[model samples]
Target: MALYGLGMAKGLLLTFSYLFRKPFTTQYPEKRLTMSPRFRGNTFVWYEERCTGCASCAKACPLGIIRIVTHPRPRADVGNDYNVDVFDIDTGRCMFCALCVEACPYDALHMGGEFERASYRREDLVITLDQLRALPKKPQTQFRPHLETAGYKGDTELDEHDAGRWSL
Candidate 1:
């Protein structure tokens, strides 16, 4: 009957061993862990220069949280020939789906690694064009699937127009 308590003793010994070991959890705000390449953070990054205002990202969003407003550019020589006026994303309602990034024909949108997006007001959760543009730019390897499979190595001379189109 005394041997029946052996399991509990073993369990307690295992717990004590782990208690003496160095903790793996980092003290947030002071020490931060490097986010994985696949981490889906709350922040959204948009490259204004690369965006064509095609609204493909918006269409791909099932929640319709992404909103974009665009107007024709005055100069024909300019790339895309569209001036993005309003680009807003309601992060509060967002599901953190990477569909927007995958659907962007221009490869303009990317998932950011910033996870600390707590806000006091509901209105603060809405990310604007300026905010989106301010997010850190991640290499195509992070969001572009085709590029990821290609081992992120290839000709750097890809034309801007051709980069937007994704083909099967």
Candidate 2:
């Protein structure tokens, strides 16, 4: 009987404890939480101007999610116009390891920080080139801040201030 009473007392104490404690839940939609700088989100970017139609990202993807279709540029003197006609990423199979981004020698790809990628159907998750291109570009300075902070030697093409120039 004493043991039963003790158990009941403990349970009641736990119930009462919450009454005095602050609520942990936030009113979402009204409030938001900031993720870490390194947080990888579900936005895909294409530096269409920079891509050399290397097809490295497509080859590196283990799930075969990346597809590239290249065509010759209008002028014979100008190089091949590597347009991503059918760049489809099946979010259903994507591990988000950022291998595709790393494999891109031209820095044409990078991880974006927008994580709310819920979809009603599996087919909806498969992002098309038009959808990927529609996404707003993240500031170049936002990516790999550590490298910039350390003053690493590399392409000085993309700096913090020059981030907002690109559109589409």
Candidate 3:
């Protein structure tokens, strides 16, 4: 029967076709895939200037991974400015829920796009304030209002406003 070997021939042809096609698998270490605009990465970006030390982010964390310790600083206008003494997020315990980011009213907190957070010790995952501040600033696209109302509307483009309210 002519059809008997046709199936094998087609299978071989399909296999051979892949040789010329571009690979879908990325050579991870050498070539990294660009993360989506909405992707909630593990690294947290903290804008020290915008942070009011309200402890809102800490309270919103479901896992209690965020810990904030603030001390009052005498201010001429406000009477007392809350200076954030300790702002640490135990990333190991974090579930990447983005709850903390949502609770930040000042837009001081945002999730970064850096995912290469592998570490040998658990202590290394508990990100300190210094580490958070040291991270390169990224867009603050993940907002509570945007998320709740679905305002993102499939638009992943980060605008000036969305790009980490630094100037504000």
Candidate 4:
């Protein structure tokens, strides 16, 4: 019927109107898209020196993906009470909630801005203490307002001293 054809023509016109417009999707790999300030990315940046071995990050994780091992310090009263021996984060099952990052009282843990970590094996996704030590400390400003105030836009990697507002 002519009425049916009219509806079809309207749909075709709408499609054509948008066909020449700029696409909303970014050309990935060729051009990296900038994430928002509060984006909870998959990558994590941790500074061990600032960590107090309190296991606060592990306790705050809703998925229980973080596992920490600590030993009593020789002189507990001297500085930090415990010496962190192990800090493992199973990113394979992480939800990217950012709860652990916010719960760290010592400002040692932070969510990184990059999300390009793609691995074929599940074991490769498990981040150990050694791997954490090697990872670049490029922290995103999700909850830590101090990092944002310090002009950390999450684009560049920072050293331990500059990562947190209250340095360890």
Weakest lDDT window of 10 consecutive positions for candidate 2: 159-168
Residue 35 in candidate 2, Cα distance off native in Å = 1.7
- The lDDT of each candidate is 0.73, 0.66, 0.76, 0.85
In model 3, where do residues sit more than 4 Å from their true spots? 1-17, 144-168
RMSD of each: 4.9, 5.9, 5.0, 2.0
Which ten contiguous residues of candidate 3 have the minimum total lDDT? 151-160
User: Which candidate's TM-score is highest?
Assistant: 4
Error of model 3, residue 13, in angstroms:
6.2
Ranking 2 against 3 by TM-score, winner: 3
Candidate 1 lDDT over 1-168, as tens digits, reads: 678799889989999999789998899889977655556778776777788888999999999988889998777565547888999999999988788888986777776667787999988999999887666654334556665565533223233333343531
Question: Candidate 4 — what's its lDDT?
Answer: 0.85
lDDT of 3 by residue, 95-165 (tens): 88888888888877877666789999999998898897787676435663453243442224343355443
Q: Which sequence of candidate numbers ranks them by lDDT, best first?
A: 4, 3, 1, 2
* Best-first order by TM-score: 4, 1, 3, 2
Q: Candidate 4: which pairs clash?
A: none
Please list the residue runs of candidate 4 whose C-alpha ends up more than 4 Å from where it truly belongs after superposition. Answer: 1-3, 76-80
TM-score between candidate 2 and the true structure:
0.69
